[model samples]
Target: MNRNPHGEIEEIEEEYNYVDAPAWTVDKVAAPQDQRSLFFTQSFPLIAVCWLILLVIMGLRIHFTSESNAKLTAENQQLEILMHLNSTLLAAHENLGRYCNNLTVQFDLLTQNCTVLESKIKDLTAVNQQLTADVQNLTTRSLQLETQRNNLTKQIQNMETNWNKLNVSRAQWSIDAYCPRENNARLCKACQEGWRLNQSTCYVVHDAVSTSGHKTWEEAREVCRRESSDFVIVHNQEEQYALNYYSWFSTLTTGYWIGLRAEGWRWKWIDGSDLTVSHWTPQLPPAADGQCVMSVQNVGWRSVSCAEKKRWICKKKALYV
Candidate 1:
C-alpha cells in the first residue's frame, strides 16, 4: 500500500510482507520468544522498583555480615592479648624466684661474717683480762721490793752508829799513851827494866809460877801485897813476859788473879785506878757461882771463888823515872 505523505488516514506500511493470503487476525496474536526483555522494556518502571528493592536487601545482608565479622575479630584479638599476658606473668615469676635465692645466699654470708666478728671480740676480751692481771702482779711486786729497801736502810743506819761509838773509844785510849812504848812486836823490854817508862813510874814484875795450887781470893791478894812492899802491878806486855819468863804463873788453871774484882759489875784497883786492862774469858763472872771476877792465866780465864787459896800474881810500880 502507498501512503500519502501527509494525508489523513493513509495506509501504514507493513514490516512483514505477508504474501499469498496471510492477513492479520484477531485470534492469532504474535508473542516474543524471550518475554524477560519484553517485559523489561514494557514494565521499565516496575523493574526499576524491583531492582531498588533487591539492592536494599543485599546491602542489609552485607551490613549484617560485616558487623558479625568485626565482633569475632575483636574477640579473637582479646584472647590473643590474654595469652601474651599469661606468658609475661610466667617469666616474671621465674625471675622473682631467682632473686629470692640470691638474697638467701647473701644473708648466709652475712651471718657467717657476724659470727667471726663475735669470736674475735671474745679473744680480745681474754687478752685484756690477762693484761690487767699482769699489771696487778707488777704492782704487788713493786710494793714488796720497796718494803725491803726500807728495812735495809734502817740496818745500815744502826751499823754506822755502832762504828762511830767504837771510833770514839779508840781516840780516848790513844791519848792515854803519854810516853809511847817502843815497838817490839807488842813487847816493851826497856820499860819493864825501869829504863823507859810512862808518867813517873817503873815496872817491877814478880816471877811466873807454872805450878798449880788452889788458893782463896783473899789469901792470894794478901800474898801479892806481902811479896812486894810497894805492891806488884802490871805495866806493859814486857812486864807480863818477865813474870812468865820467871814461871810465876800456874798452868794447872787457865786464870790467876792480880787485883781485879767485880764490885757490883765494876772492877777498880784499891788506889781508885780503873782496871781497864782485861785478859779474861767471855762471861767470866758466873751468874750463880757467887763469883764476881775472872782471871786469864797461861791458857784461858775462868771464874774463881773468893775463898780459894792459890798462887797469886802482883806487880810493883816503882816511883822513879
Candidate 2:
C-alpha cells in the first residue's frame, strides 16, 4: 500500500506513473447508480408539463371543429334558399315574356285593321265627290230642256194667232164683196168675189199667207169641190202656158199643188182625165207611189209626197151672187 502526504504512517514502495483521459471518453463511461436515479427524479416534472400542454391543444381543436361544422350547415341552408328564389324568379320572367309577346301580336293586328278602314274611307269620299258632280250636270241639262220647251210653246201660240187672224180676214172680205142683185139673180158673165174672169171660167188663187190656203193634193181637191169648182185643168199647151204665167205672180217658192197624181203606171188628173202631156222639168226622174204633181217656181213640175202643203188654183163656171 502507498500513502500520500498528510498521513502519519509511511511505507517505502516502487515508483508508478498515471496518464490523463479525454472528457468525451470519461462522459461515455457509465455513471454510478445513484447519479442515474437522481437524474430521473429531476426530469419527471418536465415530462408532466409537456403532457398538459398537448391535452390543451387537443381540446381547442375539437371546439373549433364543432363551430366550423355548424357554420357550414347554416351556409348550406342559406345557399339552398337562394337557389329556390332564383328558380321562382326565372319562372316569373318567362311568363312575363310570353305575355309581352301576345300583346305585340294584338297590337300589330289592330294596326292592320286601321289601315284597311282608312283606305275604304278614302274610296267612299271619292265616290261621293263624283256623285255630286253628276248631280250638278243633270241639273244644268234639266234647265236647258225647260228653256227649249218654253220657246217652243211661244212659237206654237204665235202660229195659232196668225191662223185665227187670217180666218177673220177671209170672212170679212167675203161679207164685203158679195152682193145679191134684183130678183135674187146675179150676172153670169161677172165672176164672184175673189175670182178672176178667164175664158168663161172663174179662177181663184189661194193666198199662201192664209191658214186655209196651203193644202195637200187631196185636201186641195176637196176644198175646190166645196166651192162648187175643181182644180185647174190644162187641155192644151196654151192653157198650160196660162197656168205657168199665173204661177209667176205667186209669192211661194213651191208654186202650187195640182190635182194630178201617179195612178196605175201613169200620171192622171183627179177628175179622171188622161194625162197625155206633161210639163215636167228636163231630166225629171221617174215618179214613186203616193207622189203628186207640184208646180215649182222656174222648174215646171215635180213629183212630191201627197202630204206636202202648197197653194192651189180652182176653176168653175161663172155664177151670179
Q: Specify the poorest-scoring 10-residue window by lDDT in model 2.
A: 10-19
- Shift in Å, residue 239, candidate 2: 1.5
For model 2, what is the error of residue 192's alpha carbon versus the real structure, in angstroms, after optimal superposition?
1.2
**What lDDT would candidate 1 get against the real structure?**
0.54
Model 2 RMSD to the real structure? 16.6
Model 1 Cα displacement at 316 (Å)? 39
Separate clash counts for every candidate? 19, 0
Q: Which portions of model 2 miss their true places by more than 4 Å?
A: 1-179, 182-188, 210-213, 249-253, 319-321
Any residue pairs clashing in model 2, and if so which? none
Superposition error at 27 for model 1 (Å): 10
Writing each residue's lDDT as its tens digit, candidate 2 over 127-209 gives 89988998898889889888988988898898789878977976554444444354775333356777887676777877577
Please provide, for model 1 over 1-321, each residue's C-alpha lDDT reduced to its tens digit, 9 standing for 90 to 100: 222364322212221322222566522323322443574576677767778888888898889878878988887888789888888888888888898898899999999999998999899899889889988988998898889889888888887897787677554433323234456323323233323243443433333343355456666666656633233344466545544443344454534555555565556545567555554555334334335343444543455665654455555453323
Q: After superposition, how far is residue 36 of candidate 2 from its true place, in Å?
A: 99
